[model samples]
Target: MSQRKRSIITASLLATTLLAASPALLAGNHSSHHGDNQHDMTEMCDNMREGKGHFNKADRQEKMAEQREAMANRLKLSDEQREIWSEMHEEKRQQHEKRMGKWQKKMDERCAQSQK
Candidate 1:
């Protein structure tokens, strides 16, 4: 299970890196004279975004369950451990959401400022 988890994490990281690198690839092709290529790029971006959203939803659910199980097993945990884990998990989750929200707001402001 640990190996599987590591593999999933590695794969997710690789996918994220590849996705981030894609804009460079697209940008490199800007000298292309083909109009259809632009349309294809737009379609690819839309499809990739939709696919990523679905993948993230499913991946997050699976990771949460796996994390709980792994923590329980590694800790030789009891019911009390489970309760404590839940509290810790919720706290971490809320913190992450808050951080992400702030990050998103900052990014939006930067984008808006750049546009202006």
Candidate 2:
């Protein structure tokens, strides 16, 4: 009934709702872009089994570059704007790689432990 208690309850509810919806929101976006969820999942599994979980490094880089160009084209960025946009995008990519590296390390550790 207290004001502080009500604020805590509201914050908890907001946090819970966001946590629940985040994965569904991500899956929705991913499926819309990739199409054929079943085929995509099968391909992912095959890649993992083939020890190419990260995919070919060169291919990955090329795909990313292509996507960047597509994005810039879609936005119709000017030269200067494109340069700034690319620099920002590179920063985000580096941050993502770092996070993924940490996640991969943890997953490897877990798998190693399970094997033992």
Candidate 3:
């Protein structure tokens, strides 16, 4: 074969080989990433159940306090306005807790039923 023809044939073979290997390579890459994510999520859940998650209750409360202080400062609330804001915040927190409690109970019941 001529040099030009030989070069074209070699390039064609290389391209075909890569195209044939691409799907398996992509699939493996995807599964590896997915597996890592799944493992991380499982570890997070286990840590949370053990009260050791990234943002446990104290961390969350501290963050909320910081946010509240920032908001109060940003809004330049007066003492009375701050009191009102506190009251509203507490009311909303209670409502959220109640709603979450109901949701948790429902989920627990569903889990129990599924185990039967």
Off by over 4 Å in 1: 1-58, 107-116
How much does each candidate deviate from the true structure in C-alpha RMSD? 17.2, 12.2, 7.0
lDDT of each: 0.73, 0.78, 0.78
Query: lDDT per residue, candidate 2, 83-103, as tens digits?
Result: 999899899989988997897
Candidate 1 lDDT, tens digit per residue, 1-116? Answer: 69999999999999999999998887865466588766665554554447565326568768887988897899888889788988988899889879877865775565455445
Q: Where is model 3 more than 4 Å wrong at Cα? A: 1-29, 102-116
Query: What does candidate 3's lDDT look like per residue over 1-116, in tens digits?
Result: 89999999999999999999998887654667877875675565556456575537678768887899899999999999999999998899889789977966775575455446
Count of steric clashes across candidates, in order: 0, 0, 0
Collision pairs in model 3:
none
Could you tell me how far off, in angstroms, the CA of residue 115 lies in candidate 2 after the best superposition?
2.3
In candidate 1 the C-alpha lDDT for residue 94 amounts to 86
Models ranked on TM-score: 3, 2, 1
Q: Could you tell me the TM-score of candidate 3?
A: 0.54
